[model samples]
Target chain A: MQHKQTVIDIRNLSYSYVNEETSNRVSVLHDVSFSVSECEFVSIVGPSGCGKSTILKLIAKLLDNNHRNIGIDRSKMSFVFQDFALFPWLNVRENIGFGLKMKSLDKKSLDIVVNEKILEVGLSGSEHKYPHELSGGMKQRVGIARALAMSPSILLMDEPFSSLDMLTAEKLRIDLLNIWTKYKMTVVMVTHLIDEAVEMSDRVIVFGPRPTIVKKVCEISLPRPRDKRSKEYFDLCDLISKEIL
Target chain B: MSRIILGFHLTKKRKHIFTTSFVLISIAVIFSYIIIISGDNAGQLINSLMLSLFRLVSAYAISLVVATIVAIFISNSRFGDMMIPIFDLLQNIPSFALIPLFIYWFGYTNIMTIIFAATSILWPILFYVLHSLKTVRRELDDAAKIFGAVGIKRVLYFLMPVAFPSLVTGSIVGFSIGWEAIIGVEIIGLASGIGQFLNTPVGNNNNQILGISALLIIVFLINRLIWMPLLRKSQLYAA
Candidate 1:
């Protein structure tokens, strides 16, 4: 098999969250290192409070970098947050075009781009509706559309579907994979759901409890349209879960 | 969509448009008439009042700009973190205490009146802006950074919009304080203003009470026509 090009490389990354009130530093990630290849769907899964989300933020360069070595070939990245992070004041169309507007795109081009993404994300009729007017699933769809509008090489998602109902999550996951296939971008997702990690990712990087370390990296050899009930799929889920437990 | 009519949310689309237009036209007509027709006595009083109001509005605008800029800088810097307590201490010093120095520097002119009112307006606006800036969600900030929102663009797009509700709230409080401060400055410094009308008789014997009534009406009109609309408009941006 031909080796894929590495898009991200992290070496000896260590981080701690400082409690403002107490001035106490709680180590979250410790000497953590991982690599992501171009166009690969990778999920970081672990027990709750294992700093799975912290790893994503570190990769996105959201946190301060005084304590770690992290490298990425891509200059820009986009995020789909758990809470959907849609601006409450902006309607669907405006929310989707936020990044493009920040880049100072012309009004005509911005309108075209925003409209295209809104349609692509299945929020066509809801363009005029505010975040408060949308259902949870629709809100996440808008969030995903906003991230995609930037056309980043790497997409970072922190618990993107954790807030949705089971059926909604399942549906969104399938739709997301379809979008991923079309877009052909590198995706790094942080999730607590082992089955989700196994189902969606080409590779699953498991994390241990804080201070977190990479416990295991599991490759899912299951074919596309993975069956959740299949022995191979369940086995992979079991393996990743065991590493966390 | 619902629209505001007579301070109530009206559901009928057609009626809302009609009412909104009527309200806008009526306000414009009333203000225009007030500006155009004034007898010599009423005209002088109106001119002084208008001048005082213009000073307050201009000073308030300046306060907004300065407070937002200072708040953004301080909220983003470590040095600023240490200075917040010192800032709180500075705010506690009475604004009137600065009036003596202002009078000495600017000499009881319109500049002094404006500066004094601005000082009164500045702290609440600054503190509220700082609080809003500090409380902005980590996710939103990260989102902004990841998407290349920086410098003035960042302030205009992310910071200001997120801090808008606080800004409006702070402005309401600041304007109230500004009104009081301006009146005090005019009365003390012997500058001509609406406050001066209150101290002396207008047109006839013992019209001081009438002047006070006019003052109350002007305050009510300003609050109704300007601040209330601004507050309502700001609700669209408020989180």
Candidate 2:
């Protein structure tokens, strides 16, 4: 395998929240560390409240990191939120072009990029629809397209498909993989589903329960469009499930 | 099935439009009748109504701007955290109680009337916007930051839209309170306005009835023409 340049690096990253009622520091991520290479698909799998999402937030700098040893160019990053986060007031095209608009891009260029993303995400006919009008699957597609419109080098997904129905999630997982292949950007996803982690990632990093640390980093070397029914696929899922549990 | 539903919606919309037009025409007829019957006093009444309308509008505009700025400030900083309780206390003080203090400062002036009304109007808008901003979904806030919505861009593209529906609701509430404040101030101190017109001792009960009827008509029109449309549009902001 060719060595890809490292795009994200975290060493001894820890975070705590001050409990509003108690005013006591409640630790979330304790000495958690991981790294991702350029063009790699990585998933962090763990039990509920294991700080998997916190790690993603730390990378995106959405939450204050307090100068932790986290390395990633935030300007080159885009996040796909769990709840889609499509601005309710913005139509599909406007939502996708939100990042570009924030950058003060010219209208001509903005329209071009937005139009292209709309097509790329299979939302070609729904450009004028609002978020409330979109189905959960379609909304997430808009979410993904919105992130892609930024032309990001790294994509961070915080349970991007967790809110979708089973069929929608399955279809989106494949669509996401296709988009990922096309873009060739680094992806770091946090998901609780072991099968999803195994099905999509080049590597899966499992975390322990709250105040989390990296429990294991299992490399998935299975070929493209890995057979989900195959024993090997189940074994890998089983392996990750064991590590997280 | 879709076409049937669409047809039903269209029929309902037409019925609504018809009803609105009928009400508007009725009000117009009533206004014309009032003007004809109250001949000499008609001009004075119209002028007073216009003046009161202007005062209410000015106060509303000022309140909207101030409330938005204050709400954003309170929602965004630690200073805002401390100020919220103080603002809550201030809002609780009956706005009418502050009229004497306002009169002492500005003394029966238009400025005093507008300012007094603005104080009454500001609280609902400020609290509504502040609550909306404070309660924004965590993921949406993250998405905004992650996608380069910071500084003024964040406020414009993210926060403002997030606060928009609540802002409309607040404005509607604020405008109603403002009407009371403006009228109360006018009736108590000001020399001219609809409130003064209404309060003026008249030759007959007809003039007083006309004044009250005109006020009601204007309020109804404003609600239908402005606030109702805005309230409908604001629903798009809901997630």
User: Which candidate gets the maximum DockQ versus the true structure?
Assistant: 2
Residue lDDT tens for model 1, B1-239: 23356335444656868876786687667645544444344666677678878888988998999999999999889898898999899889988888889999999799899988998899999999899899888777777787767898888888888888889889989988988888888877888887665556465633354445556657767777778887887787764
User: Candidate 2: where is the Cα deviation over 4 Å?
Assistant: B1-16, B202-205
- In candidate 2 the C-alpha lDDT for residue B153 amounts to 86
Predictions in order: lDDT: 0.84, 0.91
Give the alpha carbon lDDT tens digit for every residue of A17-72 in model 2. 99999999999999988889999999999999888888888888878867559977
**Winning candidate number (lDDT):** 2
User: What is the DockQ (computed on Cα atoms) for candidate 2?
Assistant: 0.83
Residue-level error in angstroms, candidate 2, position A26: 1.2
Error of 1 at A125 (Å): 0.9
Cα lDDT, model 2, residue B173: 96
What lDDT tens digits, residue by residue, belong to model 1 across residues A47-128?
8898888778878777776634878854667889999887777899988998899889999999998888888889988999
Clashing pairs for predicted structure model 1, backbone only: none
